[model samples]
Target: MRTFYLLSLLLFALASCQQPAQYISNEGYIYGTIYHVTYESPQGKDLQPEIEAVMMELNQSMSTFDSTSTISKVNKNEPTELDELFITIFKQAQKISELTDGAFDITVAPMVNVWGFGFKNKEQVTPQLIDSLKQLVGYQKVHLENGQLMKDHPNTMLDASAIAKGFACDMVADYLYSQGCKNLMAEIGGEVVAKGKNAKGNYWSIGISKPDDNEFFTQQKLKAIVELQDRALATSGNYRNFYVEDGIKYAHTIDPKTGYPVQHSLLSTTVLADNCMTADAYATAFMVSGLEKSIAIAEADPEIDVYFIYSDPNGNYQTYVSPGFKKLLKKEYE
Candidate 1:
């Protein structure tokens, strides 16, 4: 699975555009990345504090970087009961894993840590080490039973990095909606959920990065801009967090089945769905499944709209946008 950060550069509302509404924006750091939230409500309404409280609760429940987080305790094999938040994400992960035939798995934590992509630093990632870690890397090896996690193998661990941010987006959006805000855009990390419309009375506009490997985030140029309304969007790419070793490039997206970094021309995958969590998980799954399989899966599922950026035979960037997704695109790079 690929965990990307700082990839979305969204245009909240065009300044010159008409506005019958006022949009309040709030931003801070969470989940190792920045989050920006904007919503339209009455003049005296400010939900920054409420948003922060929601984020704090989610971080405590799911962040692997926090040693005292609920997920960290579960990963350490400590006796811990699964909270509602944890169970919801766990079940959703299991569903996606099964739907993707294990391509998107939560039990790939050991491989992620070994590859220097998870909470821990990289270790000696030899072939033998990868094989040893593979033994503990199956979603089927873990399950939640009566609000407690059960493991077929004692070493089976979990990592929700792939899907947690999207869930966070959903949670924050729900909070805003509960407060009677009909128009809102909730984003955590790079995953986003746009509800109602922007201040301009138009669907929110979000830009997807051009999959440039020069920098993790700095060299951002838009590949496309999408109009989102009552929908969630997420992009997964391996352009960042990769290295060149022995004349070969190693990307961060690990194929859970192969126990190695994926080597493919598919540069990035962006998915749109009813909720951020589903979009987030499908985006990662599409990256693992490669181009053709991803398109096939997207075509079969009406709920999923996909857009892919890939490198062609001559090493030029190319694109394949699904029909449903093409309708959502506002502009493409010239």
Candidate 2:
């Protein structure tokens, strides 16, 4: 009788250990964009609230649109103490700016605002305006002292929208990881961090949309798809976000060097890095650097992989995929 009782307990323990893993997804709107996070949970728990809490914290720190946000106060030159999020991202931005030769400057906020893509109202842009804004657009003009951001010019502003969404994705991934999620994917807007195998025991998949412009800005066609494992991806493109005025087009991506919107054939740049923040910054830098310069820089960095989509002189789409990035493709993108 004792032996039979012991055998029953052992069998029950084995059954409990063999429980199948389930995928739990939590999705909502934050940062003015849709965020989706899915994780493999053996406990079948949804961590939407916790995930949202992290996003809210980030917004409170760096959302320029929110008057009460920390960044808003800084942009206004108000006497406000910088938060850790601001310090970290600000330093990261500086590093990327230096690495990209000032192509990824957060101090381009003044230029961005004048171009009508920032928090301020759009104005009639002119060469004189661009030249004036150039004075306040270099990353070297700002420094952090005692948790305070000191600018060379009082009007010099900072904008981290290029990297904030990607960092938010990283933050959510970090939270999920702390909660014991090994296999998961986190995406904000289009920036993503994917690690481990997915619910179906395969690496996560990310899609790159076709470079098309429209009012709604929906995902119309897939230019390509990539399988990602233990890595992050970020894409920057002007195709979906631009305005035409006076028979000329102006994209949101501003060149800090020239204080003008970039006029480049490089339609989209997708970068894969160890973290979403790095990928995001590099992707935007590539957009500002244009094709040849971006190619040279991308080749020099072994930690980054890139896939560039540009337009040929004849208006046909052309693609350039790096060797490392080529390995991640599910199949050749025709």
At residue 334, give the lDDT of candidate 2.
52
Candidate number with greatest lDDT: 2
| Residue-wise C-alpha lDDT for candidate 1, range 240-294, written one tens digit per residue | 7677768866677889988888888889999999999999999999889889888
- Which parts of model 1 are misplaced by more than 4 Å? 1-21, 118-123, 215-218
Global lDDT of each candidate: 0.87, 0.89
* Residue range with the least summed lDDT across 10 consecutive positions in model 1: 1-10
Q: Give the per-residue lDDT of model 2 (tens digit) for 1-334.
A: 9999999999999988774767998888998889889998766677888899999999999998899999999989999988988888998899889889999998888887786744234568788888888888899999998888898999988889999998999999998889889999999999999989887889999998878665344647888999998999999998777777697666778889997778878999999999999999999999999999999999999999999999889878899999999999986455
Model 2 lowest lDDT segment of ten: 114-123
RMSD of each: 11.3, 3.1
On a 0 to 1 TM-score scale, where does candidate 2 land against the true structure? 0.90
Cand. 2 Cα-lDDT: 0.89
TM-score: model 1 vs. ground truth? 0.90
